[model samples]
Target: MSDSGPSTPPSPDEKPAKVQFNDNFAGKLILPTEEEIQNDPYRRRASSRRVSRRMSKALAIADILEQERQYVIGDIIDLDTIVEADDIEEATTRTRRFSSVVAASRKSQASTKDWRELEEAGDESSGEDEDYLIEWEGPEDPKNPYNWSKLYRFFCLFTVSMQGFCVAFYSSSYTAGIPGMMAEFGITNRTITVLGVSAYLFGMGVAPLILAPLSEMYGRRIVYIIGMASFTIFIIPACVAKNIQTIIIIRFLGAVSGSVGISNAPGTIADIYQSADERSKAFAVFAITAMNGPPLGTIIGGVLFRYLGWRSINYFSLIAAGIFFVAGFFVAETYGPHILREKARHRRLTTGDDKYFSRFDFPPATSLATLLRRNFKRPLKMLFTEAICLAWALYLSVIYALLYMSFIAYPVVFMGLRGWEPQIAGLGFVGILIGTSAGVATDPLSRWGVRRHKVDPETGKIPPEALIWFACVGAVLASIGLWIFAWTCDPGIVKPWVFCILAGIPYGLGTTVVFTNGWNYLLSSYSIYAASAMAGNAISRSFLGGILPLFAPKMYSNLSPAIASTILATLATALMPIPFIFYFWGKHFRERSPMLLALAAQSGI
Candidate 1:
């Protein structure tokens, strides 16, 4: 049997971990930093090693599975198969991960389970050498999520994808009902009415701080079910809200409950698909749904608001939420740790062996408060302290804020000025959808770029910087599109409307490119800490999304359409070189930043 002992002792200055890495894990291994070789793999699933809020849910699931266990539970993401995907930075923020807090616990292995005991690829991590362990029956085990039938896997994927789509759709669709809301409440202030959307975003931003730990502790399914149910229930109040305050509060509550879909969908995909090819495809589908849902929301909202009034939009989200609430109940528990514990329980019940135990068989050593504090603090710390985190956080916030701002700007341009009906005006956002589709179509080109880029001679993994070229292209495209949209959107001109609307194609495509590539860039660059960086990014974006819309009505009202948009265009143009700057010098900064270090320890490059 291979020795399960940890790698060479840590230097005095570094923190110690009770983890051991195989000299060769499969054919390739990217050795983990001492930090990546952690005591609690559960924490990593939710935070340090993850992407956005729920993006890391997949990684957390896969990363935990990647840990060698005497009791194997479908080892996922071979070191070389860097688990990366989706423009879900907001979908799965770092603040929502359980590890942001508990991951800091480098305590003894008593409370943790199978995660702690692998002696080698062939053995489990053990406190006692004599304790026997159980592993996968083989690669063919039906219990393994990866080995499940394609039809079943697809079913699971569809449900989770719908969940994400619903959450994203809620974002833009809410903007459409503002006019009805203003009329019903007899409010004249655009900023006050827009506060409804802002409130919803704020709930999404804040609720994850608590949900992150709950999902890890309870498993992802419960969170989804409860969240969906709460979301569905909360919308009822808003539907018949007597005052704007009620709509604002209920929307906030609904969003808090609704966030589970965005927060856990990525992990569900990660849990089900371990192959990089399959995972990438899964994320693409997820990304497309999330992106597409937002743009299409305006069209739907327009028709609903025009025909049934603003209440119809919430009714629609509620109905969708209700359907998923029922569906969520049928979904199986996908958290690897939870699954293993169940398997271990079955073994002990049938065989009557007291030693039958999973890694997390015992209760957690850390308290809820500790988990909360850690999860909350680490991501915020990285947001400010880490250069990569701060830059990406600010960049993504601006991008998302600008998109939300468009909700106000588009209506102002198309409806207020052009004398277009709400139904007709809502169609304006379809351009963005078309642009996103165009962006997704470029995957082949991105793949070619990845292949063409210089690879690590040792690991054969494409460097993270290879993703920057597309980002640069996206930045330029986004700026040009925004500029076109701005200049052509003059309120006084009629012929320019077509040109202005057409500009959304480039803007949508450009934003899609930046979000998608930028997300992957962080994944490749910050091997483990990507979760925190992404979490901070989401928080900032939500903050901006909530606040920026308030400025939109005012800015567009006070300034000429071209001038207002040009101010935004200038910002986009200024950011166009960000990717280029990172492409050349990001590595130097990445190497020096304590938070952004690439854990090149895995050999599977």
Candidate 2:
């Protein structure tokens, strides 16, 4: 780093010379200006993922390079000699690399004017019209979502959790009022009544493909606002629907709008929590509601149906939607680009400087199309081609579908065979609720177990495999729980109905842990592309959840109840080895993907 001894340092009045910006250097904390992203085709629409979404995992690696033990303080980087590094280790290597740039950046940051100070002097009269990069003043910058007050962040998470729960709850709760609706519509066919649930699931699956890109374009809060508003407007039609067609169609539309919570919450959670470990605990709350919402909604819906009618479910949804609708307004924008744009806009207005620009803006025509295509294609590509994706998709699909199928199976066992009241039959899923809660309660322990693994040398944090242990254990627990429910729920067996009901505990716990860790594993592995992978999985899971339940009635009617339950337990068992397969080979598989290596290289260090 040293050349020609006895060199004099540049004076404060002499501005630093401009160097060419590297669009591919996404791993660096320092980003290119909004103009750079917009003008360069390669950088447009890519910063949100490469810069913001990938921040937490990227920082874990970046911070390792900054440690005092790794570098000498006197080193200075000459940008002209720096070559673009293709991987994290090379990018991070202490000998004349991006790490040197990082050390030099830290050294010079204290001497420069922050974005705010620069903004104040941004008047056109003050100097030449030169574009300046707008960014968080520092790691603790209040403008950054990660630096938000803990209590307020939790509030946002709570709002997000409700969005997920209410949508999921409504989808399942519709099943509770099927009998009453069928009677009023003069419909005797059970298959016809199931259509409403299928339509809603369809909406849930399809909506996210569109919403994911919209969130990027507008920010999380705008999506939340639009979704909640649409949900509220649609609930009235659902409540007033005169026939099955009206109910089915309205519920589908409702699900499309309400899906904001289910599809987009994880990104927001990542935005707020910089540490993967912290995200685990936060996601646990999300997992509890998303996984258990169906059963809880059914319990409440059954009670409402017994007293008021099936129409009350929509009314109930309306009330919940109304409350969250208002709450949505209070939720801050969490998307990194959107927030930076707003800051840039503010600085422009205050200082009347055209040069004040957010580093994440995109040119509307080309960038939007490219982003949309990426949002649509990459996940499917990974799903079909990537081994890690294929296994998790199958395992998650079975576990997810089982939740929906339970809406039908519970009724057949508790009402058709046991003769329990429709209202009372809803209580069967209590074990599911218990299990889901238990999983959340034990998430810390699960994360702790994962963190016990050797830290990754590059990222300086636990690897994606940290989530696999619980998923493996959860797979077994889920299968066992299903087998117990299958045998114990049969009237010919000596086991009590309570035992079948209690079986949900293991299933619920298994489900919560499996799902929570499953997502975390993806997040850990893919980093930026995690959203694309997750959105694709949501579609498949929703399709199965909706379609599989259509056969529940026939399954119970044709086969013995125990046998039907055993079939489900068997599916769970088949997938039991999936987590184990992943735990061992996940890293290897992840390593093979060129994009993953790029992500690790760019974000790791």
Candidate 3:
């Protein structure tokens, strides 16, 4: 072959073809000399730039070799001996190919390194931080929460849901034991039920500020396990209480422990799902479990109360708490930072290196003052600033108040007014359950509507408005259920069943809509601050739930069941059109919301 000139130009009509070569080439340059290639600005920039972890690692090893002046032109690249080039031309091409590989690898690796630095920085910042880990800790790292098997997550979800169920159940279980409690304590006041129920609700509300923030410092799994184990351990003291005051104290403490079940669930779920659709499904599952608990609790509490006696409620709670404790051991830490910290821990241990550190490992302590600041300030900020959060909270609160109100009043209407037996009285709860089921059943229609109508031609995303329509249908059903239950109880032949069905209709549909929309709204609107926002919602909804029972008895007695229910149903009816209003104007409202605007701006929306 003829030797070409140093700067030969290509023919005007010819385009230069990309050079290809074997990996094992071990000779000098076909074109530029080593010094010239190194000095080329493009080559220098490409080499200096960040790349894949594997490539960076390879280059680092190559750098060490180069520093030792270890390369022999004729020798094969030892990194992979199988990769070889035959001649000088082939070797030149191979070196370029390997360099290209290194550059590409560095580019890929850069993302992992940048993410790690950010996560570590976040973890070290404060205990209240919520950043998730994104760095790889080798392939299929167990510390990566997403890498955890489905069975593991399901177990966690089940345990939390069960704990929530137990908490709600225990609130009412004392009803069966009230007589025993009164007899033992020489107390006959009707306020004991209120006292017991309020303690649990109060505990739930207060513990999150204390415990949830600590979850940032310690971890979600540890906090849940410790909390639930304490609750189970506290059950022994609560069950054998000789006086009302002792029972009250123990019960309150147990509730504080159980509160983790509800408080941390949304946070955990948020950490798991990355998309709106997945989140909607996850929220739906959680809503089913969370919303189903109260009625199920009442049902189970009544049976345990009647057959096993008042202490049996606590006994069952102890069992549930124990199961949760056992399950908690298997429940991995899902908090993003915690996962990263664990990965860092593993890497440190395996590689015998101190440089590997996770963001979760060094979180600051969230002190009482910080807790107070966060608890008081964040909620106020969210409630006042986020219109969607405020609106959804209001809607859910009203629905919950009505639910608890119904719970308080139902027994009286069926047992006292209609003269039903205790067991038959318990069956009245089925109406509520049936209503919940209806709402759950009707939810798919809303999703289908979203698929059918809300499609954006450009991005193909469903409008959030399509989801709100279910809320309207639910509200209308709630009004109807109220109307039927209100009017059908005059000892007529068709009274009980007709009333039950009517009561269920609205409740089922309405609750379904309420839960679906409320959860989806939180997931969509407050994607980053999902935990704090949901915490605020939990507080508001729980407060309404816990307090409604205090006045429900008096309201039913004074106004009578028909009027009492009608008033509630009427309120629901008035709120029915809320969905339509939101469906039309919701995005505008969100756009106008200062909190949402700030978040959108921050997220570069």
Top lDDT model: 2
Per-residue CA lDDT of model 3 for 229-332, tens digit only, reads 88888888877877778887887898888777766776666555434455446656666766677676666666666577667778888887787678778766
Q: What is the lDDT ranking, best to worst? A: 2, 1, 3
Q: Where in model 1 is the C-alpha error above 4 Å?
A: 1-134, 346-354, 360-364, 456-460, 491-494, 596-605
Better TM-score candidate (2, 3): 2
Looking at candidate 1, what is the lDDT of residue 191? 91
Candidate 2: worst-modelled 10 consecutive residues by lDDT: 68-77
Ranking by TM-score: 1, 2, 3
Q: Write the per-residue lDDT of candidate 1 for residues 225-319, one digit (tens) a residue.
A: 88988888898998888999898888888888888787667777778887657876776777788788888888799889999998999899888
lDDT of each: 0.67, 0.69, 0.58
Clashing pairs in 2: 88-601
User: What number of clashing residue pairs does each candidate have, in the order they appear?
Assistant: 36, 1, 19
Best by TM-score: 1
